[model samples]
Target: MTAPVFVVEGAVPGDGAYVLDGPEGRHAVSVKRLRAGEAVVLTDGLGAWCDGVVTGSEGKDRLLLDVGPARVEDEEQPRITVVQALPKGDRGELAVETMTETGVDAIVPWAASRCITQWRGERGLKALGKWRATAREAGKQSRRVRFPVVADAASTKEVAKLLAAADFAAVLHEDRDAPSGALASAELPTSGEIVLVVGPEGGVSPEELAVFEEAGALPFRLGRSVLRTSTAGTAAVALLLGRTGRWG
Candidate 1:
């Protein structure tokens, strides 16, 4: 198996040594029980990483590491961004986690008109924090050098703007007459941002659908059966990855 991955605040890849401390260090030592001389990888979550071995423990929550040469990885082409409408309770975090692990480059929380969950003030901030934390943890577990970004909640208008800026954008809807086609059939660019918008549990409103399509976001369907709001984005991303040759 590959060495377990960890995230550091900042990284100088070529440096001969580095420290793993604080909460992550504690987890490595106490939870993972990483002993001295075990191999590990540390990343800055921006494509820079260093492979290293634990030299010794400085304290309960700290480890000194002897790092080898550092290297920077190139970001993948046709970067994928998922605009996921907020789901009820912890379902939002579930979507974020799965999407992150599935190779989404970024995630945007959407507050659709029909959304049952409304985020405001402290609640919204806390929820956003949870999404970020989920993405970070998922990235570590997936051994990703570049972690997905969890963007702030987006209103319908903001989501439209994002769709307009994307090279290719698709809005997932289940309508039979919505000019819907299989997501797998869509033509993706070789490089650039590709955005996928998923509506809430109540689904996308007609007015919202019009706005998205008007912004050049084509309405697409995943398959014959409809999926829950929490998993739709993840499935759509998988299709995109395959279509763009990222999965191969």
Candidate 2:
């Protein structure tokens, strides 16, 4: 079996000994049953990683393997961001996980006009934490150097504000009259942020679409068939990544 990968807090070199802590530490010791001589990979979630061997397990978990030299790669092209409307139950978690694996640069939880599940009180923060954790694990598994950011839930108005700050923004609507073409085929700006907005289960209300349209977000269709909130964002990310030449 391949050695399990873990994310650390700081930048990693291709060679060196580093420490693991928190959940990663627990996994290395308790869950993975790693002993003091096994090899594992560690990443800083910013395109830096090291191959090292487990050196110690006392106190805070520590790895003493000789790290290879550091390698730094440019960030993914197109820098796709998915502004997904929060789905009920585990759907949001599933969406975030899949998007991470598919190479989304960031994620924003959107609360739209037709959204039935509103994240409020402590539940909102809790859910956000869970998604973040899921994203981190997915990134490690996919060998991605960066961990996708999960923004706090935003209302329709807040989403508009976010779009104003972005270079390219589009809202995925089923009612769009035009055929939803592949995002890769779309003429995107050479550089700057790209944000894709996805609606909730009930879908984006007419008013919400108008709000996004007024904010300069072009409406795009994903295809003839409607996709669940969970699948749309992941599918969009995969297309964007492939178009940007990140996917082989």
RMSD per model, one decimal: 1.4, 2.6
Residue by residue across 91-174, what tens digits does model 1's lDDT show?
Answer: 998998899889999999999999999899999999999999999999999989889989889899999999999999988887
Q: Candidate 1, which ten residues in sequence have the lowest lDDT sum?
A: 175-184
Model 2, 94-181: lDDT tens digits are: 9999999888999999878687877888988898899898998888887676789888888789898878787888888877786657
Off by over 4 Å in 1: 176-181
The whole-model C-alpha lDDT of candidate 2 against the native structure comes to: 0.80
Best candidate according to TM-score: 1
Deviation from native of the Cα of residue 166 in model 1, angstroms: 1.2
Give lDDT per model, in order. Answer: 0.88, 0.80
